[model samples]
Target chain A: MTSAFALSDHDSAQLPLATELIAVIVASSGGAARILTIGGGDRLPSGPLESRHRSLQSGLRAWVEAQTRHQLGYMEQLYTFADPDRTGSAPNVRVISVSYLGLTRESQKASFSDAGWRDWYRYFPWEDHRAGAPPLIAAAIAPRLSAWAHGATTAALRRERRQRADITFGLNGHRWNEELALHRYELMFEAGLVEEAHRAGADLRERAGLFGRPMVHDHRRILATGIARLRAKIKYRPVVFELMPDEFTLFQLQQTVESLSGRLLHKQNFRRFIEQQQLVEETGDIATETGGRPAKLFRFRREVRIERAIGGTKLPTPRS
Target chain B: MTSAFALSDHDSAQLPLATELIAVIVASSGGAARILTIGGGDRLPSGPLESRHRSLQSGLRAWVEAQTRHQLGYMEQLYTFADPDRTGSAPNVRVISVSYLGLTRESQKASFSDAGWRDWYRYFPWEDHRAGAPPLIAAAIAPRLSAWAHGATTAALRRERRQRADITFGLNGHRWNEELALHRYELMFEAGLVEEAHRAGADLRERAGLFGRPMVHDHRRILATGIARLRAKIKYRPVVFELMPDEFTLFQLQQTVESLSGRLLHKQNFRRFIEQQQLVEETGDIATETGGRPAKLFRFRREVRIERAIGGTKLPTPRS
Candidate 1:
C-alpha cells in the first residue's frame, strides 16, 4: 500500500486543479431525441464544483438546474475527462470535467433565456438511420475517411487506419452499429474532419460543417459518450422508461427507442419482445390520438426494477 | 453556459485536492476468485496521481505495477469516488479516488513482500453461493439486518427499511442478486455490522468479527464495487478470457465464471450457450490433467472482440 497521504514537497506542489460538472440532459418527443443545450445551443449546462457542494452528483444536479431551470432526473455519471490535451485550459492549471447523462421528458420547457432542447440528430447528421443511413455518411464522410486512411505513411499503417475506419463507420460490407456513436465521432476527430480537430490545429477549415456542429471544448465528445452509453444501456436495462411518459401506447414507446438509438425496429418484433419481457402492463386505457385504430396504453411495471435487477431486461434489436 | 473557467478568490481558496488512483486487480484460480492486496491484505495498491502521469489510466497502471510489480492486461474505469464523507483524509485536503477494475491471470507472482492474492470470499463471505447461500446470511447478517429495519422510527420508514433489507439480501423468498455485492456491503455498513462502521463511531465493536474483515479506508467498499461491476460485466462481455490461461477445458471456463460470479452454472447449458455464442474455438489440444477423461482445450476467439463489440456477449446463468 503506497500511501497517498504523505506527499513530498515537489509532489504536493502540483498544479491548481479544478473540477467541472457537465450535464447531457436528454429527452424524446415527436419521434425525435433531443438534448438540453445552452449558450445559443453551443454548450452543455456546466459549472465548477464549488466547496459548498457535498458530492459530485448533487453538485451536478444543482448546477444543471440552476443553469437550465429544469430539474434533472434519472441521472448517472457518464465519464470523467482529465486528459490535459482534451481540456484546452490554462497551462498552469489542470481541469477535470465529470460529465453526467440525465433522462427526462420534454414537457417542461427550460426557463433559462438561452437554454433549449435541440434535436440530437442536428449535431450528428450521419447518425440517424430511422429512414435509412443518412446520405452525408456516403457523400461526405466516406471519401474523407478513405483519403485519411490512404495518407498514412506506410502500407501497414494505411491498412490499420482503413480497417479502423471501416470498423468504426461500418463501411464496405461492415454492419452499421448504432452503439458505436463515440467511436465514429472519435475516428472523425482523428481524421481531422470535425471542427474540434480543426480547433486542435488540424487543417480542416474547408470541411467545417460537414461532420457535425461542434460544442464548446470537448462537450460534443462528452455528448457522444452519453449517446453511446445510452444506446448500449437501453439494450440491457429498463432505462428507456426514464424518457417515456407515465402512460403511452406501445407505438410511442417504440418510436422513442428508435429515435434515441438512431435506428428503426421491426414493429411486430419490437411489440412481441416488449410483451414477452413483461416490462410494461396495460393501463386499462386507450390512446385515441392515433389517426388509425385506437391503441392500448401501457405503463412500465415498477416491480421489474427490483425483480430484474439480476436478470437484466434484454431488448431484442435486430442485426443491421 | 455557466463558465467553469472563471473562479472567484473565495472559490479559488478551496481545500487542497489530491487525486488517488486505486486498482482492484482480480483473478480466478482453483475454483476461487481472488484480489491482489497489499499491507497484509488490508489495503489495495494505490498512489496519488502525479503530474508526470499522462492520463488517469496510465497513472493507475504505473502505480499498480510500481507497488505490486504485476503487469495489468485488460482494465476499465469502474467508478470515481469523490464524496468527501467516503475519504478519511486530512481536515483541509480532499482526496478523490478514481478506482479501476483490472482482469489478469494469476500466473505472475507479485514481487513485493506484503503484496499477495487473497480469496475474494474471505472478505465477502456472504457473497458466495456456489453450493448454497452461505450460512453467514441466515446466521449473522439477516437477524442484525432485521433489527436495523425494525429500529427505524416510523412505521413507513420501518417498512421501507425492511423491504430494502429483504431486496438487498434476498430475504423471505427474494432472489439473491449476485451483482448487488456493493449494496449488501453498504447495507451492512449502514446497519453498523462491519468494523469500518465501528471505526466511524458506530457501536459494533462486539460484532466486528461477524462480518468479513474490513480493509483500510474504504478499500473493502471499493472491492465490493469491483466485484459487482465484474459480475455484471461478465454476463454481457467476454472479459473472463482475460483471467484464463492460453488453453483450457470447457469445465475450467465454467469454473472460472462461477468463481467470479459466486454462483453455480449448469454445465450442459453453459457449454451449449458458449458454443452458440461462438466465443471460443478448439485449440486442437487435450487437457490430460483431469483424471477421469481427457478433455479438449480451447482458446478465446480474438475476432469476437470486434464482431461482438456492438451486440455484447450474453451468459445464460440459471435463475436462482
Candidate 2:
C-alpha cells in the first residue's frame, strides 16, 4: 500500500537532479516586436539552476542580468518541461527546464555585443495579419498542410488533422485567434512542416525555410509560449506598458499594441477606447516626430493598477 | 558565464532527492461541493512520487486510485511548490511538492474507510454569500482582521494591510469577488488569524476558531488554490458537468455551480445565458424530483466543449 505521505529515502544519493532556466525576454522596437537572443540570435538566453540562488525567479533574474546586462521588469513562470525526450536522446537522464516570460522596454544602450534582438514575426510570418493574411499561408503552407492531412493513414486521422489545421491556422474562412501562437507552432511541428520537426526525425528537408526560422533546441516553441501569454495577457492586464516608453504619443502606443498583437486597430475607435479606460493621461507635452501635426504625449496612470481589475482593451476590428 | 544548458553534477549521488504529490480531488454532493481527504480528514490524500510511474500525472492517478479506488475523470496540473519551508521544519532538505486539481463525479460506492468527502465551506465559511454574508464574517473575522491591521508596527503598514483586507474579503463597501478564494485564505494566513499562522510562529492564539478549521499542513492553502481555479474555470470551460449527475433539472445544475462558487446566481438570467450558449439540451424526460413541479431533464451538450471557446457564465448580480 503506497501512502501519499511516505517519506523520501533518507539516502538522497540516487535522485536525478538536472534543472535549467530558459528566458524569453520580449520587447517592442520600431513598430516591430522582438525577443532577446544569445549566441548571435540563434538561441534564447538560458542557464543552469544554480544551487546558491534563493528561488527560481531570482535565479533566472541573476542569470539573465549577467548575460544581457538588461534588467527584466515584468516576469512570470511560463511552463516547466520535464519530458525525457525534451532533453535530447539521453534516456537515463532527467532534466527539468523551467521557462519564464519577461517584458521590458527596448533598450537604446548597448550592453552585450554577442546578444541581439530579432523581430518575432521573422520566425512566424503567417501570424502577422495586420496587412491582411500573409501570402505564404494560402500560397505555400496551407497546400502543404492539406497534403499532410490527406496523407494520414486513416480517413479519421486525415479528417482530424485537417480540422486541427483549419481551427488553429484559421484556414477555410475561420477567423484567426491571435492567442493560438503556440498551438499553430505545435500543429506545424506535428505535420512535419517546421525545421525543428525535421531535427526531431521528420523528413521535412524541403519544407525547411518555407516554414519560418527555427531556434536552437526548442527555444522557438518557448518564444511562441511567451508570445501567446503576452497576447492573451494584454487583453486583460496593463502589461503592454512594460513594453512602452515612459511617455509617448497615442499613435505610438497604438502602434506598439498593433505590432505585438499582429493586428491592425481602427484609429478613431482605438483612441476612444483608450480615453474611456483612462489607462493613460495627457502629459501636456507634444511630439512632432510624426510627419504631420504634433500629437499629445501621454504617460500611464500608475494608480489605475490598484484601483480595480481593469477590463480587457477591445480591439477595433476592421469592417468585413 | 552561465548557460541555460549547463549540466548538473555528473555524480548525481549528492542531489537532494525529495518529491511529493498533493492532490485536490473535488466532487459535488447534494447542493454542496466537497473535497476528498484522508487521515481522518486532517490532510489531503497525498504521497511520495514513486519512481515506477512513467509520468507525474500517471503517478498521481495511480496513487489516488490505489488509495480511494475511484477513477478520476478530468485533471490538470495546478502549480508546483518547491519552497523548502513547505516541507515542514526540516532545514537543508529540498522537497518539491507538485499539486494537482482533479474533477470527478461524486463516488457512488464507498472505497477507503479513512477517506471521505467534506464540504469545502467547512474551511471557508466567509466565502459563501449565497444567503448573504456568512454571519461569522461580520460577527468575528472582520473585527479580528481590523485589530491585526491596527497592531502593525507602522501606520503605512497598517493602512496597506487594511487595504489588502478590504480588497480580498470585500469589506468596507467592496463587492465580493468569488474568484479570490486563495487571496482571502492568504490574507487570513498573513494576519495570523488562521491556525497555520501560529505554527509559522505568529502570536495569534486568541483569534483561532474565529477562522475556519485548519488542515495538518498547507493543505488548506492548496485546497484554496483548487477552489479558486474551479471557480474561474467553470465560467469558460463547462467543467461543472464533472460534478453533476447524468440527468438533472436546470435548477440542480445551477445549484451545483452556486455551491462551488459559494454565491447565488440570478436564476432567470442564468437560464437565459445557458440557453444562449447552447450548453445543454432537453432529454425529453421530466424530472419530478424537483419537488413542486415536474421540470425538464437536460444533459450537457458535450460537443460545445470542442466547437468554440465558451465565454464565462455571467452571475446575475443582486440589485443593491
Q: Please name the candidate that would achieve the greatest lDDT relative to the true structure.
A: 1
Q: Candidate 1 docking: what grade?
A: acceptable
Instruction: Tell me each candidate's TM-score.
Output: 0.92, 0.91
Chain A TM-scores for all candidates read 0.94, 0.93
In model 2, where do residues sit more than 4 Å from their true spots?
A: A1-14, A108-113, A153-155, A308-320, B10-17, B108-113, B151-158, B309-320
Over 4 Å off, model 1 = A1-9, A153-160, A276-285, A301-311, A318-320, B8-15, B302-304, B308-311
Tens digit of per-residue lDDT, candidate 1, span B1-320: 44656653455536567788899999999889999988989999898777667778888888877777888999898787788777776756666778999999977765576788999988888999998998989987899899998999999778767877888888998888898899889988888888887786655474545688789989999999999999999987888889999998999999999999989988998999999999899999999999889999999897676555545667887634
Interface RMSD of 1: 3.7
lDDT of 2 by residue, A1-320 (tens): 55433445423323464666789998997889998887887788887655565566777888788888878888887877666567563566556677899999868464485677889998888889888889998998899889999999998789877877887788887778788899889988887777887775645475555678888889899999999988877766778788889899999988888888898888888888788878899999999889999999999996565543422344555422
Whole-structure CA lDDT of model 1: 0.83
- List, in the given order, the native-contact fraction of each candidate: 0.36, 0.21
